[model samples]
Target: MSKYHSFNSEKNIKYKLPNEITLFWNKGLFDSFIGIDKVNIHYAQFIQEQVECPTIVIVPGRCESYLKYQELSFDLYQQGYNIFIIDHRGQGLSGRMLLNVNKGYVTKFQDYVDDLRYFIENIVTPKSSEKPYLLAHSMGGTIATRFMQDSPNAIKAAVISSPMLGFYSGLLPKSIAKILVAIKLKFNNIISNTPWYFLGQKDYSPVNFTDNKLTHSIPRYQYFVDLYKKNKIIQLGGVTTHWLAQSIAAQKELFSKIVQLKTPILLLQASGDTVVCQQAQDDFCQQLHTLQPQSCPNGVPSNIDNAFHELFFETDDLRNKAITQSLAWFEQHT
Candidate 1:
């Protein structure tokens, strides 16, 4: 219900930075803090001048930095809301875990959840006493879910887009893929002290727009590609065997702990997503619905058709609807 949504995709498909968004980005605050194991975690924020407003805490996906969320943050800020985004460890401007910076790795999946807890308690709550709404995407969704379970009353509401509750197995069945990853991870641990990239995974490389499965809008996709081209610090590649193993273990724990969630949440499913399993999202919602039917309507995600993994960066037509729905969902809880 804000006019800022009209600026991005209404007139033309061409991606032009809006003057207001540019100004917003220019004046935004940037800072960092020491996370678990002394990792320096970077974050960005936009505070409204001389006005108290609701806050949105963005938990970005894997290989995503707060830098990639400029336009999205600007859009939400224009709606009179404060915006905060964190660049998680092993990616973004934050510290990397491996000697090879491009190899995605994490010592423990719970470290992400702990890092978020530190951000909320030490950073977000001090700035805004009001419980902030959570807007998490992909891998961030998994992190947010665990955080909510840990401190259920901390957030007023949440909107998770294309959550990575389950891995997508290309050729092998899910059970077989899990077994393979586990076996490879154990083999890797014995042979090498450091984590190795999963089979067929490599360093940072650009995919052609036509071949990319992230979004449909060429301009929107190009916008992010240009950012990565400009900054080598945030150019992250595929996951390591250890990272995949950690993620699988975390996913297994999530299902067992679903009954602990207390905050209201909305899961937005990308119907065409090949990055994460849709069946997993369905299973999560079905389990969550038995506990809180109002939070997840009818025990399933709110579907977005013709969308890829990156719902926020999708073509205007798709992205706008997803944003509108998320904003409305937050307003309901507020």
Candidate 2:
């Protein structure tokens, strides 16, 4: 009926119906597609068989892919919420490096917002036709926050886990960092060639760190390890100056009008998160309490203790607690 549909038909681009895993995981019934920028965008949806249930879209942090959130999807599915997830451009099984720049590097934060907007307009709404909920973690939280500010009525509610409002590291002054990144972006589109520091840690391997012991025992991590190992291009090493500048801009925008967001928000900050600054979380909640009383009526923010940056990947106790708190928040709001 639409020109895009005819174009897709001409290209033999038909939606591939998902299998049992899709139904069990509550993933939407579509596969990946190349977006307007010629970058591959992978997305999946889940639909309820009987009663219509609210949808929850899961957005992962940096260096994360759809495979990593299978557990989270399973949990949400059990809670009777359909789920949709997308692999950000250049990350996961999506398209690899563009313009010789590494995956996960973007010239502007709007790139992510655009990718999300496409997913929602083309995939989520068409499949579900219901108001969706957002569940974003870490770097994804930053992106989700910006999306909420940009499109207030796009979704009904949002749950942010250990959002990257600011990082815990006290490296360079914020002003100096912005200037350095701007110069790098001007010189070369590709910069910040250093590997992520956490990758060097012996125990930090995805194989060794899974929330589910039973699943982790079965060589599950090896699958992801092999995926990245075979496709070296998908391995986004570290953030570049341009990426940092984009992140700073997004953060500024998020903080500028966070209290004015009409969508109900559940900000989940990790007490033991060593990556994102906890003080920023406190400040954000305080501001929300003052400005948007309806969104956060109680004046007390919801927080979880003994959790780190990757709260979803924490040990069973912590991960379960995070999931419980998240579902409870969603139930309360939705």
Candidate 3:
């Protein structure tokens, strides 16, 4: 176990994964399902024996594996809900697409939706007749949104935290970033004949805690850092030009097809997020509200002040509040 697993009080915050949660994770069922193109999609589930409860399907963010969600799974299970998390293909424990395993690439964004559909139809529903709720984060939010649009009635309710409706172009304008991605993608097609990493993108490398932009809790961040270090197979590098292109195209489609969504979804915005564009999340809610008032309620996200990109992995205060709100939303529809 890493030193981060030990509870500590610092700066008026306490963070630790309890032994019982670890035991619960140890009992989890880790498995994989065949997705489109025969890509192996890894997933984890924690179901109470002979206990019927509404399931929570967790779609994680980009570069995330189901291993990173053990604490989260345990937390939700303790709340009387079964938890299910999937490691999207080309990342995590799932099958990689390119020979260079570090490079993140996807054939298309729809493949992600199709994989989730296959998983729910073949694996989740057959085991549990109750319709599952959705808890998707970051890039997973984007994939889950598309999934909801494609299969409107698939899930009961959804909680999308810091969704990747748009990318945060660091130090560059969004237009310039799109142009650069387009140029690089064209160059790769005409010259490289292989996927090229986006500018400044590289293989997985651990960054110092002080420099990370994902979360505010040092212990929580350190735990995942150590986890990736020990489990190199789940360490994924930065995005490829192809993956970025697919994501951009998917965002466009998501906005264009906003009216197709029927599942009720709660968009949780992180006020301090620098990973995805907050404006895009707002626009998505606004548009969704116009189409279906019941889906978004108002034209705005339930903002979590001072929270970072990874809401669930944030400090106890932020993480607990988000989970509580999500559970409340699930309970309402149940």
Evaluated against the true structure, the overall lDDT of model 2 is: 0.66
Q: Which stretches in model 3 have alpha-carbon errors above 4 Å? A: 1-16
Predicted candidate 1 versus true structure: per-residue lDDT over 223-245, tens digit per residue: 88988998989999999999999
True lDDT of residue 190, candidate 2: 50
Clash counts for the predictions, in order? 0, 6, 0
Candidate 3, backbone clash total:
0
Candidate 1 runs further than 4 Å off: 1-7, 10-16
Q: What is the C-alpha lDDT of each candidate?
A: 0.91, 0.66, 0.87
Ranking by lDDT: 1, 3, 2
* Candidate 1 pairs with clashing backbones: none
RMSD to truth, every model? 1.5, 9.7, 4.1
- Candidate with the larger TM-score of 2 and 3: 3
lDDT of 3 at 118: 90
Clash list (residue pairs), candidate 2: 26-46, 27-45, 27-46, 28-44, 28-45, 28-46
- Cα displacement (angstroms), candidate 3, residue 37, comes to 1.2
TM for every model, in the order presented, reads 0.97, 0.77, 0.94
Instruction: For candidate 2, write residues 1-334 as lDDT tens digits.
Output: 1211111110121122124334565434658877747778887666677667788999878777776666567667767778888888757667754444343466467788788888877778776657888999888888888888878888878888888887554576756656665666665645345322221222123335445321212233344456566656456555655566677788888899775578777787767667777777777777877777755446544666666666665555666666777776677776
Best by lDDT: 1
